[model samples]
Target chain A: MDEEAAKKLIVETLQKKKGKSKFYLKDFYKMLPDEKPRTVKNLVNKMVGEETLEYWSSGSTTLIGLKGVGKQAGAEDEED
Target chain B: MVEFRHKTPLIDQLETGPWTSFVSDIKREHESRMENPKGIDFQFNQDCCDDLLGVLELSYEHGRTHWKHGGIVGVFGYGGGVIGRYCDQPEMFPGVAHFHTMRVNQPMGHFYSTKYLEQIMDLWERRGSGLTNMHGATGDIIFLGTSTPQLEEVFYELTHNIKQDLGGSGSNLRTPSDCMGQSMCEFACYDTQEICYQLTMEYQDELHRPAFPYKFKFKFDGCPNCCVASIARSDISFIGTWRDDIRIDQEAVKAYVGGELKPNAGAHAGRDWGPFDIQKEVIGLCPTQCMSWDGSKLEINTPECTRCMHCINVMPRALRIGLDTGCSLLLGAKSPILDGAQMATLVVPFIKVEPPYDEIKETVIEPIWDWWMEEGKNRERLGELIKRQGMQKVLEVTGFKAIPQMIQEPRSNPYVFWKEDEVPGGFKRDINEFRKYHQR
Candidate 1:
C-alpha cells in the first residue's frame, strides 16, 4: 500500500480501537502487513515525533493512538 | 602445514579446565575414526575454540549483546566475502567462543588441483581455522574462525597465487558459480564455465564492493538439469537451453532395444534381462507427452520437450541435446531471512550466450544492478526488494517484459503484484489476450 493510504489506515484503525484498551506498536505494525519492520518503526517514530500519534508506554510495551483521540490506553506506553 | 598461533587471553582460559567432558568426547570420536581402514586425521582446533571464548567475553553484557554488533568488516583492502561473528555467551561455557567465518570464492566447478589445494590449505591452517566449509549457500568456501590480521594475509596470498580474488561481500555479487558445463558434461548446451569466468572477471570491482543494499548471487546451470541449482538459489540465474530439435541416433537406440544396453554391468547381465520396453517406458514417461514409439523406433517431438533431463538420462547414447543453445535468465531466488524463502522468477525467457555475452550482460545484468542500487533498502536481498516494490517496477526499469515462460512457478502467494497505475500497453478482445496481459 502507498504511504498516505497506510497512514490513513493506521489513523482509522486507531480511531476504531479507541478505548478498546491498547494498540501496541507491534499490533500497529501487524496492521501494515506490506511494510518492512524497519519501515514500520520509522513510520511510527515519525508519527510520534510529529505528534500525529500519541505514544505512551504500559510498562515496557509501547502503544500508539491517534493524535486527538483520548484513551487511557495505558500509562508509560512510549509516552515521554 | 604450519603453526602460526600465539596464545591469547581466551586460549589460556579454555586450557585451564572445565572442558573435560567435551575434550574427552572429541578424543573418543577421533580414536574411533582412526580405527577405520581409511584413517582420519582430525585437527582439534584449539585456537578456534579460544577465539570463540574471546568473542563471548567481548559481546556478552549482563543479559544481552554488547555495543559492538554486526557491520561491514574485513582484514583490509577487500570489501566483502568475510563475515565477522561473535560468541552468543561468554558466561556459559567459555571454551567454544569466537565464531567468525570467512568466505572464499571457488573456481568454476570447484576443480582444484592438489598443489593449489595444498597452498590454500596451508594458508588456512596457519593463519585461520583449519576447518573449512567446501561450499556454503553462497557457493563460497567458508573459512571459519579467523582474526582480522589473519584474514588480510589470507586474502593477499590467495589473490597473488591463483589470480582469483575473494567473492562479493556486503551488497555486491556473491560469486558466480556454474556446474561442470562443457568441461566434462555432454548435456551442457552453452559454455557454463566460460560465462562464470567472464562474469567474475568483468565485475571484479563490483564483487569486492559493498555497493548494493544486500547480497546478490548469480548461479549458472548448464541445462534444465540445473546442476548448479540456479533456479532456487540465485538472484540472477542462467540456464543453458536450445530452441531447436533433439538429435536421435537410431542405431544406438536399436542396440539398447536389442538387449545391448548394459553390456558391461556383468559378463552375462545384458543377455539375461533382455531389452527394456522403450515404448512402455521412455515414450510413456515423456512429461509433455511429446514422444512416439513406432513399434521399432522412437521419435521425439522436440518442441514439446521441456528439457527435464529425463530422456537424455534414460538413453544417453541415442539422444543428444540440440546445438542451437543459449541461456535463460531468472531473477530473485534466495533463502529466507527478512522475507520468506522464494524461488527465482524468470526474467528473460531466452538470450544468446555466445562469447563476451554482451547481450545477456547489457540487457539483463547491468540494468538490474543499476535499478537495485538506487532503490533497495539496506540488508534487503534482491528477491525481497523486488517483492516489496512490485515486480512491475522491475519490469519497467529493467525493460524485460514478462512472458508465459517467465512464470518460474505457478503463483501460490500474493507477493507478486502489479501496480494499478503502471498498466501494460496493447490489448485485444479475447481470452488469450487477457492471459497475455496478466502474464505481463
Candidate 2:
C-alpha cells in the first residue's frame, strides 16, 4: 500500500474505534501487508506531530493514543 | 598598682576617623589604670614584632580584608576558644598575634569521637589558638595564628595523639568529605562514609603532600539527594547510583493514597505526587523519572533515574534499591571553578564496582591523576581540564564509548550510530518502543 492508502486506513481505523484512547500501529501495518516498519513509523510520527495522536512508551512497547482521546474515552472523567 | 601606657603615635595612626570614637570610649575605661605608679609589661616580643612586620607588609599590598593575600591571626580565648581573623592590624590583637596556627585534623565524614574532640580541644588550648573551625572552606580544621617556631612542636603533639599529619592546604589534595551515608541517610546508594575513608587512607601520601598542579577535592554522596552537593563542588565527585530498576511497593503506595500513612515530608521526601491514581502514582514520584506502569504492573525507567531514592523514600515498603550497585562518576562539575560554575558532566556512563572500589581506583582515580599531572594548569580543576581538552579527548583518554545517551541529543558526530546492529549491544525492542516517536 502507498502512503495515501496507509493514511486512509489509519483515519478509518481511528474513526471506527471512535472514542478509543489507544491503538496498535502494528495492527495498522497488518492491515497494510506490503508497508514497511519505517513507513508505519513515519506515518505515526506524522500523525503524532499533527497533534492527532499522543505516543507514550513503556519498556519496549509503544502505546499510541489520540491526543484528547483520553478525554473522550472517559479515562480521566472520574478525576475531572 | 601598674600604670599602662598606650602607644600614642601608633594609636593615632591606627585609630583615625570613626575608629577614634571607639578609642575614646576605651581610654575613658582605662583612665584610672593609666595614672597608676608602676609600668605595665607593654614591650613587644621579637616574634610578635616579626609577625607585625609580616602583617604590615601584606596589608600594604592588599587591603586588610583580602583573604586571598592576608594571613589569618587567631587569639586564644579563656575557655579554650580561639578568635580567628584575617586581619589588617595584627598588632591590635596582641596575644593572638603571638599564638601559632593550628590545623584541625578532619576525618572523611568530619566525624570525631568524644575523646578525640576533647583531645584536639585541649591541644588547641595549650599550643595554639584556643578556637577551632569544625572544618574550613578547604575542608580542614583551621586553628589560626601560630608561630613558625611552635608549628613543629604543635604538630608533633597533635600527631603524637591522633597519629595523622595536618591535612593538605595550599596546592594539594585537601581533605575529602562524604555525606552522612549508611550511618544516617536512606538515599545513599553507595557507602559514602567508606568511600571517603577509603580515598583518605588510599591517598594519604597525596593528601599530605602538595604535589598536584593545584588543590584537588574529592567529595562523595550516597545518592543524588546530594547532602554534600559533591557534583557541583568537588574536583572529583562520586555519586551513588544504580543500573537496576527501582523496586516499587504497590501495596504501600495504595496505603499512602488511601491515607493510611503520611508521605515522608522533610529533606528526603523524594518526589511530589501530583494528583494521579495510586496504582499509576509511581511514575511521577521517582527522582530518576524511572517509574512507570501500563494499567497492570509498575516498571522503573533505570537509565533516566539518578537513584535519588525519592520513590523509595515515598513508598518505603514498596520501593527498595538493588545491592552491590556502584556509582556513576561525574566529571568537571565544579561550581564556577573555571568557566561559570557547571554541574558535573556524567563521565563514566555507569560502572559496577563497590566498597573495595579497586576497579574504580584504577579506572577513575588513576586516569584523573595522569590527566591532571600531565596537563592541568595551576588552580585548575578536573572539570576545567575537560572543558579545555573537549569531551572527545576526554573520551579518547578514558576509553568510554560514545552512545546516544552520551549527549542529550544527537550532535554532528560520525561515531554515534542510530542503526540497530551498529549500537554496542544489539538494540532491544524496548529501545525502539520508547523512541519518543512524536518528536517534531
Highest TM-score: give the candidate number: 1
Model 2 RMSD, rounded to 1 decimal: 26.8
Q: What's candidate 2's i-RMS value?
A: 29.3
What lDDT tens digits, residue by residue, belong to model 2 across residues A42-76?
57656665666554322112345656655332122
lDDT of 1 by residue, B1-440 (tens): 22322223433454468665433333333233334333323233433443343343444324445322222235443446766544444344233333346778888888899988887766666566555667777677777665544566777888897565776655456788999999998888888888899989898766754445567888989898898889998989898888888889988888767767643223444355555767765777788999987767778877788877777777788888888888878889988778889998877767888888888788778888777755666567789878888777778777877665655467754444555555564343578867986875
> Cα deviation of B436 in candidate 2 (Å)?
38
**Model 2's CAPRI class?**
incorrect
Total backbone collisions for each predicted model = 14, 18
lDDT per residue as tens, model 1, A5-74: 8888877777777355435444665788777644665576566556676543221123446655553212
The TM-scores of chain A alone, one per candidate, are 0.71, 0.65
Residue B403 of candidate 2: its Cα lDDT?
54
Residue B146 lDDT in candidate 1: 55
